[model samples]
Target: MDYIKLLFALLLFLVGCAGISPKPLSIDQRLAAIPRKDAPLEHKLIIRWNEQAVPYLEAGSDADLAFGLGLVHAHLRGGQLALLKRISQGRISEMAGPFTTKVDHALRILDLGRAAPQIEAALPDETRRWLERFVEGMNYYQANTPNTPPEFSLLGISFEPWTVRDVITLSRLVGADVTWFAYFSLLSERRKGQTDEASWRRLIATTQAGAPNFRAAENDSQLLHDLLRASGRSGSNSLALAPGRSQSGGALLANDPHLGVQLPNFWILAGVKSPSYHAVGMMIPGVPIFGIGRNPGVSWGGTNMRAAASDIINISDLDPAGFSKRSELIRRRLWPDAKREVRFSSWGPIISDAELLRGGDGETLALRWEGHDPSDEISAFLGAARAKNASEFIAAFKSYAVSSQNILFADSSGVIGQIMAARVPLRSTSGRASFIRTLDEAKQDWSTHLATPQLPMQLNPQKGFLASANNRPAQTNLFPSSLFSDDERVKRLEELVLSRPLWRVEDLVQIQTDVVSRKAPALRDDLLSFMPDEATKRHPTFVTQLKSWDGSYAASSRGALLFELLLSEVAHKVYADKKGRVSNAASQWSYLTAYLKTDLSALEPHLCKEILQDALDKAAKRADRFKNWGEMHRLPTQHLLARLPILGGRFTLADHPASGSRETVMKTYHGLERGLHQTSYGSQARHLSDLSDPDLNYFTLFGGQDGYLGSQNFADQVPLWENQQYVRLPLREDVVKAEFKRVLVLPN
Candidate 1:
């Protein structure tokens, strides 16, 4: 009897463990479940898959191609697609349970889908037909396919049909103003009592100094932007080389978009051929357009313009009766549905009603974002994908409304250009540095808007190369906010571009992976100069390493680790307030370094020396804990599900040594954690296209092509990304047919 009881206990334990980490179906198992020989379609469509699981869809008509793409996307990333739709619609709580209530509340307040219905109504007839077919394909897959992704059952997600509104909503989600990140960071600091006028002025000045110009030649909370980052929205780096600067004598384009490090990357690799669209490149899973890709006439990429498309307006003085209120029912998986009230003002939504803005201290604030207005990003991207020249491409984005971008292009004509693509709100008062506006000011300031031709643009600059890395353009007056990234990445790109007279596709690849930091060396030199003699004598080995170190943040770099630790210590000491709390404004490395350079020089001689010595001592103590930079700076390739207790480790795709710093051209952003730190944001996908040959396009995703958990292709492309290698996706039909062997046929 005792033996039987013990056996029963062990059996129950094993079953519970299995339930925690439920195994997903194999790729073969999932694919076998789907009908391969035929499908419900308007025309015959052929789908071919490469060894890496990248799909190439060929169809008789544009609508059919759209349907085929929807089928392929659903087959590979059905779970991700479902989750994203829920997120965009503020319905995640219905699937994930009570923990996501706050998230749903925030999303409801932001109302990402506010303009979706209007945008859909205004869509061109052709685009609408394409979108409807895509929706049909997705619904067909969901209805017929069996053995779907395991996450669906685990999360209790219903297999809902896809809609055009869902696509528009997802676009808005991706284009959530990046400026909100700056706003949240600044607001958090203000909540910490750093709200004095002098502090605000100093912070604004330091931020402005970091902006770089392309023409010249240039959050932490579970806030909306935080959720956006988790849903894959972040910065990027893009460069275009005119024929004169290219070794191939053909224009070349290189792009690497940055996003939070996670499994099942935000992008999918695919090629589509149809009457209206013939392009090969990356596409956001739910969105139908190819965001970064190359067509027969041009290759293109983009970086976020960091446009001030929204403003936080203080409505504290406004009458409460004027506010509009609506009740939203938030359903949780295992709990009773809760009704929450969402308030809105004439300006926009009362964003302060969300926990994200609870720090507003009794003040009521509404967020007036350009995304709330009716606009068609779908038409803009579709137009861009079909554009045959620089002028057409520029005109395509004339009505682009939000998530502004520096759209860079390299055309078949060897013409390279950049256009600021966004409908920016023109402030009534020029040079308004504060992100927060008074209610009266908000009503008047944002009355006018600027579109494509009115925004700053450049065509074939004298330098023969154009690049954007979230830098301020040459015309600062055109943008309302100066919260741009420091010029480290852009400056490095310019250096590499001008390093030689001409460049090849291979050279651009090298530039993309370059980890050298110009700011690091400059900051190191400044620190060394201020170091006390006694401190250097005490830590001879540390001083020697710093002196001999170049600014390369390679995996094996010991000097890089030491420099980072020292910088963190120095920043803390320099920016600490009277209460010993360091300002969040200095959290930006560029601002910290700039502030230190100026402050160190102006400080009393003895005080500067003392601070330097103290910082060195602290850094040396921490440096003793790590063997090299890679040991401390790691890339966290874990899915959000990794937060699940005991089985979390199973969800982690990879946590390995990584190179690059916050400001390096190859960005892997880390903070001032004392010992080991994991990088949360960095390059997630890379694309390079040489217009010389139809087969010269190369691409790689930081994660993989397939989003299925147990699929062998899930993280297959990670090695290629890490090694700076690429998969050649050719536009030539013969080459594509020869390369992709696995096939599926869909018949009308």
Candidate 2:
């Protein structure tokens, strides 16, 4: 779908159109104007702001650090933090427009708002203290600030004092099992005509954990839209090469988490110093601690395990005897005065089931997801943030009960490993059926957990490195996980890592930006074999370009564009009847591979010529305008309001031509529309940590730290990020102090 449509929907989601745009707050202005009461206690610590507005927080105690971190967040990212909390608690509709009604309904069904309290209660006292202080910091910032955060002001919403539960709710959105997999699973099943109870059960029993792709589509289902809006491609590259393989004689870890491009960016960088912990890395706005950063001895990064943490069950018939139903009043933005009752069954949200169904089949589809329950997800990563070594890191994960993460750990002690961490469910005989039908089939529960001892872990493998990019857990499985990403990315990563005997932080960045498409080589070879002499002669430049191409989707390479066009055309022609079956290039490759296995005639000269000609003609029209791939394959960071055509320029980040394809190590996946690939989803955060010097961390978020349009930090990192140029992130107090631009000393 075009971004304009998305923006239109977003505009509706934000609220009824208000022509008012809030003036951006200058960083200097904000810091200089800090109220005395809101200022940090004089003896407590110093809060330094860097030139980029990244916080360098120092405090006497961990609690104080957390408090200062909260203040910094409120000062810079308070609007973002509040938005996340609101969205998680299904309150987006309260501030956003009527468009968010379905999303709000979906959230209410999952009951994240109610579950937040439970999650908060599950946190250990120590963790709770850290969290409480963080909230207090935000509340303090709010209480003292003379003006609201710019985003909040633009939306005309007043700031609310945050609770610990709000923080829990924010963390849960990241760690929860809320996925679009269930909807896709059911859609695939329905497409297969397996609507019958017995067929449904059989399908569920037959299909393994890695059954659904969860591909994006134009579906009117609110669940689909909400999930698509809230989430991006759930994959990342996290690898730690042991000291043996590094030139520095220290393990090097590289991590790039691929997610949807959002307004104001998702991850923010912060440097924290306190008596108990002093570290620097990315801090999720609402959550405490440096989420994916290095501590003193150990550095950790994570990739989505993409585990089968959810299933959709078709409850065609329910027994009235034992079932219970609950009704909740839902007030929507469109009809603020009106209240509607939404009914829910014990299984899940029945209202969503009705809304999602195509026809009134009387069959209720219940989403049984891991995230629906109250969890200690917040505690898991927080514990990880405090971990000192490999042993501690592993132990910390034992408490992780949210969605699975393929965690890669490397420490100064020369320990490098990968651990599949999450509350992996050991499905029962019936529960093993990921796609279930009927109450009988869904009755079985997931009682046994995949214990820490059983979870997939590789400690300093002989190869001297451990990596995961949403691939299969291991050669052997502790529990069946849905390996969504094909081994293309991991294979490329392994190739790059193994080929380079000695790895450096720069080498890791190169790998992160690697764009060599695995499928391209084979596809090019096949196309060359089928190219007619006459057509080849007519398009000599095109033929030559293909022959000499290295297969990297670099912006300047005309071959990459031509190849992509041809591939898309051929795939569409071959699978025109089977829509959504071979939509992606990977699926196209699979189809082409199968066809090649049988006969070569499928790609004979005539059909190949037609596909190539069509692609060439389309390319010729656009090729004259673009000098390099970047011009066409522009990566525009999204701002919530940027979707509007006129205001898009304001919300959109300065364009940087991004390299890499869907299958590349860089993995810049985007929508291919209007003969150009406009990047929408890709790496949101990239980090390279040298265990030799924990302070020698190279990291970049897709956007700057500040979400407020007024702050100078907003979109400040785009140029560096676009060029893959990483600024040094100093974790040490001395280094931060040296580079510090401003200081705020709190009063005791």
Candidate 3:
């Protein structure tokens, strides 16, 4: 049946493709089409491209460098940037038609860009000028460039001029709070009528056990979850080694940001050399700042702190006269423009008004997030980029507001430190509390804010290294966040870091790609201990293979495949409802792993035994279909457009065997579907820098640098990334000139 549906979809795609024209230009042709010599610039700037299309920009002033970066971003990622702007502004329905109307409605309710104009107005003089120049460069490229990505034509999008407000809004979109995913997971279960006290307690306990941090009592709206997922901004792993712990006798920094696996990758590799700014690292497509990279004195990387930056308020008791309301006309590509009504309370936007979250009970819920306030993340990152030392770096983000992070940095002066870079709210209830609060409770709790200085910071801890994999940081007077990622990845990193007295860059690379699962072995042993003797006899070969397994999610391991299948079956049996349907909420790996860790004897041991026996029997019957884990576990590097059946195959860059599981240090996230599954989220880009030498920096992306379809540079780095290799991005001018031969000089 699935095959037949696929065939029908393919037929439709073929019929549609017959009418499409003016195919996207190749990378070389696109480069040729760009205004190389006559680009609008205040000073001579050179953009040198390497074999993989990584650009090294050199300019006399920071303004020109910003302009050149804008041009480079627009030329390579115009489609992605355009899509991001639309997403940020709640205008995706304008291009994708009615299919995205609900998405647009949700975005409108959340108003992710509400703070952009205020942020733009308050920017420092130099920062405002910097953004103005950057916008100018982006608009110039859009107006002058002859090539347009195929997506623009296919989606019927008209590229518009860039603005500072647009830049700030996109920044807000990229930094949207990631904790909302966990929140939605918990709340969606409640919305489904699983609101019994015992069930709710079990759900919260299981979630907390796996992640081990503060959790919200109230559930989150789904709009923020969908937005963050679409934006491809998720968790990350970052570690900084002190000079004493490094073989090079200088601080070392390594980072790998986990994001949704797709094409045109989340990051673009770039190096900048100007009077005020000098650095090389990963830059987000639309934003003009080095998110993770190294300068002459310091190298820095960060993980999402998962801070409780927002709260859902129940304002049903509030007076309707106090609520502000507005309506927006949502434009659809081929369909008629639809009208959406957005409501706002004193706390924030009324999220319950959106079509996606309309509770029949007529309860009013508003989202009060720090992101709604005007904050200068642009100036923060800009300041950090040019900081000369650790103190300066720490001071740079004093005004940073949303998407709290644990920033780890290493400096050439033998300094290593971690700083909680966020403007945290000082709540009356300090510890973990329910996310959804009554209007009065919210008014009393959320009164003031804490700057970076008041937040947690470790300036050279005794451990000689700092690491964060979206895990809980050291607790201080005020806890940074109520929720965080599972501790398995951070534990694995600590174990590896402690295994060696002093580490080299090569040694750290091994840690970055480590595929061993810390949670798998314990879970596997628990299952084996509970297996019925008769069931073990029935699946002797499977039991033997499982026992011999070492808990490594190596692609070729048959044991890994068998273990995962058994685990999946066990979760299904244990979490089944009265009708025998497994509740997805309880069956999630995060909850299942934690639930299994508890004493089965304390919670119906006989039932657990029967479930285990049945699970083993079921898994054994299905174990013969595949040879190894790799056959079932795949890394899909395909764009969203790949859903279009026939031509979809062309959009798919690569579908190859992948290593690592959701809990492994090298995270490749998948669900228990009982058959072949592709990784949905994992390491998108990697950056490592040895501060001892400016030339000892390396970076790689899961996909390629170019966003154009069918470009040679698209997905060019996938093999290098799979093999754990990196491209050398040197800071020295001599090395840069020697390595990058293709140069596009923009004259004044």
Top candidate when judged by lDDT against the true structure: 1
RMSD of each: 5.0, 4.6, 3.5
Which has the higher TM-score value, candidate number 2 or candidate number 3?
3
Candidate 3 Cα errors over 4 Å, as ranges: 1-27, 195-227, 230-232, 430-435, 579-585, 588-590, 603-605, 644-647
lDDT of 3 by residue, 583-620 (tens): 53455455666766574545577787797899998888
Least well predicted 10-residue stretch by lDDT in candidate 3: 210-219
lDDT of 1 at 321: 100
lDDT of 1 by residue, 235-296 (tens): 78999999998889899999998876677788899998888888999998888888899999
Regions of candidate 1 where Cα sits further than 4 Å from its true position: 1-30, 36-38, 191-197, 207-220, 223-225, 577-581, 602-604
lDDT per residue (tens digit) for residues 1-748 in model 2: 3564566545643552332355566778768645546354424768888777877888888888888888888877777777677767767666544555655665656564545666677778988988988898888888987866655534546788898878876776776552344344345335445333433343233222222233433343534343433443266788899898999999998889877666577787887777777677887777785668888888988777766666556665765344445554554443462233444456665533334332234555666666666667556666777788889878876666556777888988999988877665575543343344456545654545564557768898998988787777676544554334556778888988888689877778888888887767777787567655766776777668767878888877777776665555555555434443433223323334434322335567576567656655554455556665666687776675564344456555566677877667887774333365566666777999998885788788777887776567777787777778886778776777788868887872
Alpha-carbon lDDT of model 3? 0.78
TM-score of each: 0.93, 0.87, 0.93
- Of 1 and 3, which scores higher on lDDT? 1
Order candidates by lDDT, high to low. 1, 3, 2
What number of clashing residue pairs does each candidate have, in the order they appear?
2, 13, 4
Report lDDT (Cα) of residue 217, candidate 3: 31
